[model samples]
Target chain A: MLKDEELDLLTGLLSEKYGYDFNNYARASLKRRVGRLMAIDRFPSFAELLHKVNHDAAYLPRMVQSLTVNVTEMFRDPSVFKTIRESVLPVLGTHPLIRIWHAGCSTGEEVYSMAILLEEANLLHRSLLYATDLNPMVIENIKKGIFPMSQMKVYSENYILSGGKKDFSRYYTAKYDWAKFDENLKSRMIVATHNLVSDRSFNEFQVIFCRNVLIYFDKTLQDHVLNLFDDSLEKLGFLVLGSKENLRFSSISKKYVQSDEKEKIWRKMK
Target chain B: MAKNEMNGFKVVAIGGSAGSLETILAIVQGLPKSPGAAIIIIVHRKNDLESILANLLSFKTHLVVKEVEDKDPIYPDHIYIAPPDYHLLIEDEHSFSLDSSEKVQFSRPSIDVAFESVAEVFAGRAIGILLSGANSDGAKGLLKIRESGGYTIVQNPATADMGYMPQQAINLGAAQHVLDADALVATLNGLF
Candidate 1:
């Protein structure tokens, strides 16, 4: 495992070389990931890992990928999706143009899941799903819209659990061990590489899904991101976080209200 | 209670699966009002929206028991259960951060993930207990805690309902104490 000073030196080098600010990332998790990467790549020592990261330009993306957790699936936490379907969509549908942002969207599973929901609600044509992640590799995955065929069973189950009415298989075509989703779902999505740490919000959104991303950040970074979301959100716009995350204690808490007590969905009241 | 407040241990992380709930209940029922350390429970449960495990466990203990939310502060005498579908991690010395990333060992609340986090954050101040389970999720994690200079205890395989979990830990030489239910309670109470 990388010692505390070693992690600091490595993170400092990355910031200076790559211009990505990882200074505010939660240290415990960051250390674990760095340690895991070292083990996986078989770096004999922290100094060796540091030398590689400093000299190998092409290895930067791999290090970034390892550092950023990309674990996502279609329709994860079905109950949240169910709430979006039953409660969130009706409010969003009233607007002629629905702009939804999947902030820190990993591999586009949840974005595709949202497209399916919009299609089912007959709002796909009017909706634009903006999918963004820090990792360019996952952004490329979003463009392809292909996921492992082994995951189809679980994603399909999640779709059903989220109150999906049509045959889940209709949305994707199976070839070999991968499931390629319909092009129509991809048509309405605008994909981009965005860093929540430094990038300013580009456009206003009716709903922003930044689930599971803030947990990796420290309190200051979390507040910074939350304020960014608040600034980018329109009045009464929804901000959805992960199941265990909350806006109740944040500086912007006074400006928002939770959609439901159980759900993590929050709406900007102002 | 005052004596245990000065004890080296500050967090007790318990990992279990399958037939471990009964053993957990026995421990909870035997614990006093003040355990002098926070209890973190990581159990392999289905990805259901409505989980009653916290509520069920609350009935068995006087300590505050609830499903852990992201950024919830850890305190002595409280029991925090990992929420369903999220990998619970200690963010720092003070609070937890939930991860919805990938599952480890085919389980989201994988015992290894939590145990490793506890070992990193608490080090010598941590105690890990592996209970009855059908899988080998907690074996490596128990070893990690032991390696980090924390104490590790595994339920005696003969007394475990499923036994595979504790057996694996034992096989890996992870357990500082191989204990049955009664002896386990005695050991924990002694810590308090």
Candidate 2:
């Protein structure tokens, strides 16, 4: 694993030269991810690593992907998604049309998960889902909407746990090695690249999800991004975060009220 | 608790897994109502379940208990438990950070993850406790704590319901004090 000083030296340089501000990421999480990149790429030290990112074009994207740590799955923490289905969707149903933005939606599983929920709730026809991520590679993969067929059983179980009433197999077809989700679900989502670190919100949303992403940031960056979400969400619209994430520690905590505290789902109060 | 002695230690981290709840409760009941140092506990736990460990632990102690959240400030005297499915980390001296990163030692909320984090930031001023568990997760982390000049304690393996966790720490020479539950609490009290 890279030492704290090594991570500090590299992330500091990245922010100064590349406009990638990681100066505020939690030191330990940043250290852990950078260390994994070092082992994978076999870079001996931060000096050589930083030198590569400066001069080698290919290395910069790899470093960015490594630093972001975009590991996610469909209907992860099913109980939380179940909470969204049972409580949040009904309120969203009352609206004439709904706009949902999923920030840092790597692989687009949660976006698809939300589409599935909205579809079941009979809100899909009136809903537009926008999913964004910093990694173009994940966005490309998400656009394809193809996942390993071997993962279907697990995903099916997660679907049931998240309160899906339909036959999950109906939502997808199994080819030789992959399971392709229904294109109708795909059509409901618009996937693109939007860096939470630097991008501004493009549109307002009734529900915004930035789960498990802000944990990568330091306090200052987290505060900045929470404010970004605060700006994007309509008054009384819902915000769902990672089960581990909460509004309490952020400056905007008081701006939101708990809708489902256990799920980290809240409503904008002001 | 002596003022100076209490201030001597800035952080206390406890790591465990199976058969740890009883020991954790005993330690909570024995320690002063408001501990002097920031207290963090990490136990191997169900990956997808909402943890009530903090709530259960809070009921037995006077210190405020909270399952940790991302960016929670590390205040002294309160107790923080690693929430399920997230690896808890100390961002700086005064605050915590969490991530849904890959599991270590086949566990999220791995004892080693938190211990290693505490070791990185607090070092010599830290005190780490390794208690009854079925795995070797805390062994290397406890060794890190020891090498960093922090105090290390392991539950006595013979008395532990599941001894591998404590035994591994002992094999690594990680224990400065190896005691059963009550004695473990007594030692912490003695420090203050």
Q: For each candidate, how many residue pairs have backbone atoms clashing (under 3 Å)?
A: 0, 0
Q: Per-residue alpha-carbon lDDT of model 1 for B1-192, expressed as tens digits?
A: 112323544899999998999988888788888988889999999767445988888889888997998788888889999998888888776789877666788888889999988887787878899999999898998898999888899999998899998999999989999999889989988876
State the lDDT at A43 in candidate 1. 92
Report the CAPRI category for model 2: medium
- Which candidate comes out best when scored by lDDT? 1
How well does model 2 score by local distance difference test?
Answer: 0.85
Q: What is the TM-score of chain A alone in each candidate?
A: 0.99, 0.95
Give DockQ for candidates 1 onward, in order.
0.64, 0.61
Regions more than 4 Å wrong, model 1: B1-9
Per-residue lDDT value at A191 in model 1: 99
Local error of candidate 1 at residue A199 (angstroms): 0.3
lDDT of 2 by residue, B59-172 (tens): 898888888888888888988888887888888777788978778898887788788878877888789999999988989889888888789999999999999999999999
iRMS for model 2?
1.5
The candidates' interface RMSDs, in order, read: 1.7, 1.5
How do the residues A1-270 of candidate 1 rate in per-residue lDDT, one tens digit apiece?
Answer: 456789899989999999878999977678878988998999999999999999998999999999999988899888899999999999989999999999999899999999999999999999999999988988999999999999999998999999998899999999999999999999999999999998999999999999888888888889999999999999999999987788876899999999888889999999
